[model samples]
Target chain A: EAAVTQSPRNKVTVTGGNVTLSCRQTNSHNYMYWYRQDTGHGLRLIHYSYGAGNLQIGDVPDGYKATRTTQEDFFLLLELASPSQTSLYFCASSDAGLANTGQLYFGEGSKLTVL
Target chain B: GDQVEQSPSALSLHEGTGSALRCNFTTTMRAVQWFRKNSRGSLINLFYLASGTKENGRLKSAFDSKERYSTLHIRDAQLEDSGTYFCAAATGGYKVVFGSGTRLLVSP
Candidate 1:
């Protein structure tokens, strides 16, 4: 089984505040993703990386910046955070990319509250 | 934009009863995954299908890329089955779009 860990299980920040959510996967998967879950919306992709130093914009990338420093580490940065960005964040990793790669192993979500 | 339309925004089933959840794709998807948001607020992967059907325990899932749809069937529901279920479809060559989710409540 793939193991994905996330830091700061819970966070609270104010508008314009800066917040960073970190994710680390020991699975050495080549694909990593950042997602946010909101009510009425299951999980929306924010950013993803196919490999180290590769970042791709997702369906909902506004107010979010992500970095894949290494194959095992991915970070989601919320610069100038806003109330609309408050949501449960999840990180995932997959050993494959493109087709047949949706079999993602996810980390426990991080709850972020923006005031 | 790729969109996934999931039906039955909410479902109610009694223990030992069964029901099905469906997701319809606006565009052809390469694959689909089903997950359950557990009580502890963690997503548990249930099934990942590129095509055809797969069955595990009391759950079964099928994905048809050409038909642009997928279905998840839960039989003999248990209390542990009560949770939010989501379907995510891989579209284009890059991203995956998720459904609005279905909240399932299983009672005695």
Candidate 2:
């Protein structure tokens, strides 16, 4: 089965603190994505990478930065955390194609609390 | 502008009953995916449809590219089936836009 794992399943941080959430996938997929889920709203994309060393901004990328150090690892970084940034983060991976023939395999998600 | 809209916002079903969840897309979508989020905050992929309908176990989903919509039908509703269901549409791009989600509650 395709596996995507995220570290620090839960975290609590105070305002202005720096936070980093890590994600690793064993599926060797070419595409990886980071999303934040909030109540009453759909999952909003934060960042995505097509391959190692290639990072792309998504819809809601204002307060977030991402790094794709290796094919298996994608990390989301929050330089200065704020209470509004608290959310459940999910990591997903997909095959080569854009979505025509590929399906996204998601991780268990990391719950972050910014106080 | 929202690309996807799912309805109804919330639903309640009795055991042994069944219903359908629909998603409407504002633009042309290349494909659609359905997911069910468990109470533990894990999202389980229920269906991925490029076009037409696909069924597994007691769940069925259909995607109509021409109409820009998708639907998920649940049969023999059970307590375990209660959760938030979301439909995401791929707009021929790298990103997939998701709906607001449907919160379902099934009681005995």
Candidate 3:
């Protein structure tokens, strides 16, 4: 089975704080994505990477940045966290090819609370 | 932007009952994926369909790229099947658009 692990399962930070969420996938997939889940909006993509050192913007990329340092590791950074940024974040990986087109392996998720 | 609209936003079914969730895409989708978000905030992938239908256990899903729609059917619903279900559509450009999600509650 594919394994995607995330760090800091839960976090509480004040406004203007810097927060970094990390994710690692053992499946060796070529695509990695960062998404946030809100009440009415559901899950909105924040950023995605096709491979190491590749970044693509998603629907909701404001106030957020992501880095894919390696094929297996991806990071989501909140430089200046705000109350609106409080939400459950998920990291996922996929092969993104014909062999595994829409099959995504997702991490447990990281919940961040900004006060 | 690609849009995937899913409904009904919330559903309640008794144990042993069944229902179906639907997603309508604004543009043509190359593929569709179904996922259930457990209470622990873990997303469990249920099915991925490029076209036609696929089934596993009491769950079945179908994607019709020509019609720009998809459906997920749950038969003999159980308590453990209750969760927030989401459908995502991939429409080229390596972009996958997600629906607002349907909250399913199965009560005994």
On DockQ, who's better, 1 or 3?
1
State the DockQ of every prediction.
0.65, 0.66, 0.53
DockQ head-to-head 2 vs 3, winner: 2
Q: Relative to the unseen true structure, what is the C-alpha lDDT of residue A96 in candidate 3, on a scale of 0 to 100?
A: 79
Candidate closest to the true structure, highest TM-score: 2
List lDDT for all candidates, in order. Answer: 0.92, 0.92, 0.91
Tens-place lDDT digits, model 1, residues A4-115: 9998899999999999999999987999999999978878889999999999998899889999999999999998999998899999998875356647899999999999
State the lDDT of candidate 3 residue by residue for B1-108, as single tens digits: 678899999999999999999999999888888999998989999998889999999999999999999999999999999999999888775677889999999999
By summed lDDT, the worst window of 10 consecutive residues in model 1 chain A runs over: A95-104
The predicted structure with the larger lDDT, 1 or 3, is 1
lDDT digits (tens) for residues A1-115 of candidate 3:
7899999899999999999999999988999999999876668889999999999998899999999999999999999999999999999988873234748789999999999
Deviation from truth (RMSD, Å), model 1 = 1.3
Q: Estimated TM-score per prediction?
A: 0.95, 0.97, 0.96
Q: How displaced is residue A63 in candidate 2, in Å?
A: 1.1
